[model samples]
Target chain A: MPVQDYIRDRFFPHIWCPGCGHGIVLNGMLKAIEELGLSKNEIVMVSGIGCSSRISGYVDFHTLHTIHGRALAFASGVKMSRPELNLIIPMGDGDALAIGGNHFIHAARRNIDLTAIIMNNRIYGMTGGQFSPLSGHGIKASTAPYSTIDHDFDIMELAKSAGATFAARTTTFHIKEITSIIKKAILHEGFSVVEIMSQCPTYFGKQNKLGNSFEMMELFKKNTRKIGSNKKLENKNLIERGIFIQKELPEYTNEYSKMVKIAMGKKNER
Target chain B: MKKNISFIQGNEACVQGALYAGLDLFAGYPITPSTEITELLSIRLPQKGGYFMQMEDEIASMCAIIGASLTGCKVMTATSGPGFSLMQEALGYAVMTEIPCVIVNIQRGGPSTGNPTHVSQGDVNQARWGIHGDHSIITMTASNHQDVFSVTVDAFNLAETYRTPVILLFDEVIGHMREKLIIPEKDDIELIQRLKTTVSEGVDFRPYLPRDDGRIPMADFGGTHRHNVTGLFHDMWGFPSNNPKIVDGLIHHLVDKINNNINIIAKVKEFHIDDARTILISYGASARTARHVVENRRSRGERIGLLELITLWPFPSHIIREKCRNARFIIVVEMNFGQILKEVKTCIDKPEKVFLANRVDGVLITVQDIRTILRIVQ
Candidate 1:
């Protein structure tokens, strides 16, 4: 399907600033949806407040633009209510791993059959350049005027630890890789996390003097390595980018399906 | 012949009622009075092919019910004082999003953790406005085990009909007290499945719109009509918008949806009002005592009557005001420090003659206690 046909064209002239990586991530999602042959009615898109959250309005699907950081909790209810439905949650860095961090872990731990797409732009872009949980150490934000002291959370690692069945990471610069990973994440049977390392040309890019959207996209491209590219870029090296991680844990759907069968068996016996 | 079943507790009846309602999910954490509702369901739900989960806490339990309800399942959660406080936010979300579910709060005493195992009707105000913001509700209060069974089943029907959360506000005394409940077979009782909306092929499916009859049909989340769900004030399409007219229209629709159906929501029972000099207004367990108190006075050739409020919210103001209009006195009896009494005062044109007989020591009010108040007021 044409991107224009899939998106609500009236809400478009997309909200992201020129060259913002969120646009790329969203495109990857549209492509994934098309490739899977998923009907729009089969997908419920939930989002929290932020630039990334705006994706709900743009997409031609059932959507809930929910409260800050509670998108996962609401999605949990939606998924639990209709286990047969495919639920996708798109949130900014602050929404996924900061204010909503608790729900993220618990949902993953339960292995609720859902997909969470975290757009990690490394800074709080919407409310001006403030320090987000994903911001690098020594980086300055509106709140962190001086060199930042807090260590950033590795969201992919956190997802793996929290019992995510599928975990992967990619930057917006690697469109094909991010799209491919999203396809894999959607197909995963349990809680899947695709942490798209996107770029914020407006606030984050300007603060770091990264020129504009093109420069930020260039940065994403420079940093990422392709999945199975075997190009080991050191973490310390700023230009290093690649599919830094990939793994499969016990998917929650299988476990829950077992629970349903057991519960049903008892019902039949009685 | 009607089955004159032996006495059973109100909480136990609520459990039986849940089964009769074809409840598919029971998620709750144990709290006094209300705990038996969960205990019974934990055992019985699995037998019926339903799901039961004892969540980490009340918050998770609340979320679980919301989750299950979304799956096109009838769900219920029971809690008391502190647990009810924890559930307010989720409850608010349910109200806003128009999710169908049931919540049972067997109230205990407190602004905090007051009386865990004791009866108190202190949650009346909390039930009405527990969550922040303006919203209308479908609520029922059961004064005895029979009402518990009937009202609980009714609660399920109301939830499905209105597509909103319905609170079954029972108190600790009634929750724990054993009384006879003639359990009805599943087939004899009517059960309501939530109204499902049709996604018109061309027109956008607006989940929040009030039907011509002022009710919204809830969509099975995954079945079809993947709608934009939000806490923000949105148009019928469920997209978040801050437009002034949209917000006004949405709030008005939510409130009017219930208000328009007020006649169906208000339920009360009247007793011995003809030529009575005094009227005793009460609900929940206290209503049982007031019944006996009025009976004793009637046996002595004294003129007295009782008004039992089965539905607490929307306050039954017209019935109350009319009932108390000609009475010499109106006595409000409860097991707490005067919550519903204030509501009575608002309903009555004559407030000075209104007497409050309240007890907060976590004990069930006796007929003698109400009799003593009747004497003092007389």
Candidate 2:
């Protein structure tokens, strides 16, 4: 399947910055969706505010570009009504964590059947380089002039603690890994999250003097280590980039449908 | 035929009314004074093969219903003041996109969670202008459970007809108060559904363009045409447009769609206003008190009247100006610090004649409170 087939091609020339990792992550998602033979009409892409939210506007699917951090809530409504339709949510670090963090935890806790793609660009790119929850301590940001005293969130750990049945981490440099992991997350029956540590050469990169887009991609290459890659997570500097967990918990809609069936049964009996 | 009147709460009346009016889905977060609506819906909607989801929060609850409404469902959410506050942003989204959904905000006292379990009609103005944008809204109020039943049906009807979010604004007094309600059968109600587009297949349909009737034709997601629905100002084809001409049309149509149809949208009940000189203007629980005073005063030949507003928004300015023209004075009664009182004054030639009987002590405005105001004005 061609990549263009899954896009509203006219909406291309997307608003992501030049050499921004968001476009690569978006392409990976498009390729994953196309490879799965999913019909764009039967799929709905939801997004919150940020640089990444523009993904919904560009996608040819039934897209909803909603309020900052409310995309998951809106997507839940869509999925609840039309359980047969697949839902995908793409969000940036600040959008998924700072403003929408409550929704993220609760949505995962429900184990709702949806794919949440958290593109971790490390800083607030759209708002002109404010530090994010994923922007680690000692990072420089427009908001963090004296080196941020705050620690960053381990997104995969957050997802797992919040009862996400499928949680994984990959970077934009690991293109094949993100694509395959996204496909796996989509096939998972419960709440699934794929945290892609994509570089933001414009914001985090320039602010921290971490080189350009190419250098930041190299930074991800040097640090990340997939589980069972003969490397242990005991090393504090190493990043884990494999499926953290995939368990068989009942998806939200399916259990709700069971209750629906029981209710309908009582109605028929009456 | 038999009168099937039964004792019920105002919140329960909304459930019965919604079921009768083809309620297909309910997405809400439970809050005090409004939780009963969600509890009953949890059991009833599924039994009727409709969708009900206890969303994670009020924001999601509002967002979810808008999503369901897009796929052709008559959706609703119930909340009190605090929860309704969380819903304001998404409410603006619904208004901006022209989606049809109902929001039942049972009023609770508050600047910030002032009195959650107590009653106050303080949110009347908030329900209208709370969303920060140039837009118009439909707001209905029910004094008792019976009015709650019929007006909920009407709320959904107006939401679908005008394609806007309708507010069923009441208070904890009415919501929790037990009143005799006659639930209508399915065949006995007038239900309105969203107007489906007739634009042909394979042709790119302009989903936001006003049809010949001055209303946009909506095509659901997964319909023949994959038209876009967005919060940003968009063109006829549903694509985001920065063109000045298109943005002008978008903003104008959003407010004008409901403003142009105020006559069909605004609803009020007049009591003894025909030959009265001193009148009391009120809605929701306060109106109940005002009605009692009006009835008693009229019996004593006091020449007093009550304009009970069932529909509070699109503010009904012309109706107030016309109905109260003969009155020497009008007391705007409510459980707030002069919210609707401002709107009442705006509609009258003698703005000074419209006086306010404001109350915000977390108590329902009583008949005595209104009677005293009536005496002072007279």
Candidate 3:
């Protein structure tokens, strides 16, 4: 099927700013769904409030544009109640790690069957440019005019440690990797986390003198190396990009189904 | 027929009522006085193949149930004063999205974490105006376990009928106290199932468009009719709309859907109100004490009666006006410092006649306490 088949064309042009990386993430996501041959009726795209969250509105799937920081929580409910549906949750860096941090970690801990795509732009693009949890130290934002004192945590590491069965990281510069990683994450039976390093050229780019969208994409290419690449030995600070964790764990809904059977059996005995 | 009766806590009774009302999903966080509902459901839900989740916090619980409700599941969440406060934002989201779900707030002493184990009726106003918006909500309460069971079923029915969140506002006393509840058979009580859109696949399905009966028929999340659901003011297609006309129409529809149907929504139990000179208005656990006082005073020929409110919001002003029309004294009995009393005053013709008899120090308002206030007012 064509990628346009998975999009709701009437809602476009999307509300994302010019040269915003969120649009690339949305394009990659739709291509992934198209490549996987998933039906629109079986896919539920749940998103939180941000430029990235607007992806739910643009998609042809069953969409839920929820409150900030609670997409995973809402997706958990949808997936648990209807286990046959595929849940793809897209969230902004601030929407995922700041207000929604607690729910994010808890959702990973449950190992619920959800594909959480953290569109990490390192800044709050929706409410203008506020420093986010993923905004590394010394980055200037609207809320942090003097540059940030807070350091950013690695989302892949956080998700893995919080019990996510599948964790990966990619950048919008690697468009093919974004699509492939999202496809794998969706196919994973357990909780999956894919942090796509998207760009907010209008905010994080201009505020920090990172030039425009092209320059930011160039930075992503230069700073990140494929995981286990020999170039990582030359530069210890180079961010590694690849699937970090992919193993089987008991998914929440699947385990709950077995428990439900046992519970019913016990009730019959009573 | 063999009677199915169980002497259980009010929280357990609420669970039975929810299951009876076809509740398929429950997400809750443990809080004092309201934890039993969560605890009981965790054991009972799975036995019936229903899903129950103890979410990280109250906000997640509220959001989760709203998500489940969108998938055409009858969903619920339980909390107390502090937890309900945490759920306010998501509750507003549920209101804007018109998700059919039930929220049970077993009231404890409030403002902050005032009292976790004791009863208070202070959340009466909060349930109506807690979510920040020009919107109306359906909030019901009950004085005993039997009423708790029936009212909980009514809450789900109202939620599905209107495609809105229904608040079951029971106090801590009613939640924790044990009482006898006679469980009705499945066919004994009427159950309102979710109304789904008949719009077929490959056709446009407007999820927010109300029918002639003023109900927006829903399409499940994983169904063939895929549409957007957002907290922003949206059009019939459920896409975010900043259009002034769309915004104006959506807000009016959200408010008027519940407020305009107050006659069908209002539920109250009247005792000796026909020829009474003094009428006592009360709800939740406090209504029990008020009923005892009314019965005692009526035996002494004091011409007193009790108006036990089952439905608290949209305030039931017409019923209050009609019930208090012939009464010389209308005393509002509750456990808060004049929460319902303020509403009764606004609804009645004689505001001065509407006096408040309340207790707010974490103790359940007793019959004698109401009598002392009645003596002073009479």
Candidate 4:
């Protein structure tokens, strides 16, 4: 199927700024869904409040544009109640780490069948560039006028530590990799975390002298290396981009079904 | 027919009522007075193939149920004062998005965790106006376990009928106190199932478009009719709209749906209200004491009566006005410092004739306490 088949063409042009990396993430997500041959009716795309969350509006799937930081909590319920539906939750940096941090970790810990895409722009673009938990130290934002003293969290590390069965990282610069990783994450059958290092050229890019969208894309290409590449030995500071963890685990919804069966059996015995 | 009876707490009765109402999913966080609803559902729901989720916090519990409701499930969550406060934002979301779910806030002493184990009716106003915006909500309360079960079932029915969230506001006294509840048979009570659209696949399905009866039939999240659901002021297609006309229409729709049906939504139990000179008004656990006072006083030929309010929101002003039209004085009995009293005053023609008999402290108001006020008013 054509990629446009998965998009709500009437809602476009989207609300994202020019050269925003969120569009690329959306494109890659649609490509992954198309490649997987998933039906729009079978997919539920839940998003939190942010520029990245606008992607839910552009998708033709069963979309839920929820409050900030509660997308995963909402998605968990949808997945648990209707295990047949595929839940794909997309969130912004602050939406995922700051206000919604507890839900993100707990959703991972439960190993529920959800595909969480953290659109890491390192800034709160919807509210006009406030520093986020993904904004590393010395970063400038509308909130952090003099640059931030707070260090950023590693999204992949957090997901892994929180017991996500599948964790991966990719950037918009690596568009093909984003699609590939998302496809794998969706098919993983457990809680999956895929952090897409999307760009906010209007906010994060201009605030820090990152030149322009092109320069930022170049920076993503220059700063990241594939996981386990020999270049990582040469530059320890270079961010690794690739699937870091993939394993079989007891998914929450599947385990719940088994539990229900046992409970019914016990009730019948009485 | 053998009677299916069980002596249980009010919280357990709520669970039974929800299950009987075709509850498919329940998500809750443990809080005082309301925790038993969560505990019992965790055990009972699975036995019936229903899902029970103990979410991380109150906010998540509320959000989760909203999500489950979108997937065509009869969902619910229980909490207390603090948890209900945490759930206000999500509750507003559910209202704006028109998700059918039930939230039970077992009232406790509040402002800020004043008394977790004791009863208070302070959340009356909060339940009415807790969420910021112009909207209407359905809130119900009961004085006893049997009433709790029936009111809970009514809550789900109302939620489905209107595609809105319903609040079951029972105080801590009713929540924890054990009483007899006869679980009704499946066919005994009428249950309102979710109304789904008849629009077939390949056709445009406007999820927010109301039918002639003012109800917007739902299409499950995973169904053929895929659409958007947002908390923002949206169009019939459920897409966000900033047009002033659209916003105005939506606000009116949200508020008018429940407010316009005030007479139909309001539920009250009137005892000796027809010819009583003095009418005592109360709800939740406080109504029990008020009823005792009315019954005891009436035996001696005292012209007193009690109006136990089952539906609290939409205020039931018309009913209150009609019931107290001939009364010499109206005494509003509750455990809060004039929460419902203020509402009663606004609804009645003679505000001065309406007096408040309340107890703000943690202790439950006794029949004697209301009697003292009755003596003063008489």
Residue-level lDDT of model 3, residues B146-222, one tens digit each, is 89999999999999999899999999999999989999987898999999999888887898889998988999988
Please write out the lDDT profile of model 2 over residues B115-140, one tens digit for every residue: 98888988888998999889999999
TM-score of each: 0.89, 0.97, 0.99, 0.99
Question: Residue-wise lDDT of candidate 4 within A1-270, one digit each (tens)?
Answer: 899989999999898999999999999999999999998889999999999899999989999999989999999989988999999999998998899999999999999999999999999998899999989999999999999999987988899899999999999999999999999999999999999998889999999989889999999999999988999888888999999999999999999999999999888552
Interface RMSD of each: 2.8, 1.2, 0.6, 0.5
lDDT of 3 by residue, A222-264 (tens): 9999998999899998999999999999999999999999998
Where does model 1 sit among the CAPRI classes?
acceptable
Which model is ahead, 2 or 4, in terms of lDDT?
A: 4
Q: Give the range where candidate 1 chain B is weakest over 10 consecutive residues by summed lDDT.
A: B220-229
DockQ each candidate and list the results. Answer: 0.44, 0.72, 0.91, 0.91
Better of 1 and 3 by lDDT: 3
* Reference-based lDDT, each prediction: 0.81, 0.88, 0.93, 0.93
Q: Indicate the TM-score of model 3.
A: 0.99
lDDT of 1: 0.81
Query: What's the residue-level lDDT of A35 in candidate 3?
Result: 90
* Candidates 2 and 3 compared by TM-score, better number: 3
lDDT tens digits, residue span B243-290, model 1: 999989878877877877777788889889867789998999899889
Off by over 4 Å in 3: A268-270
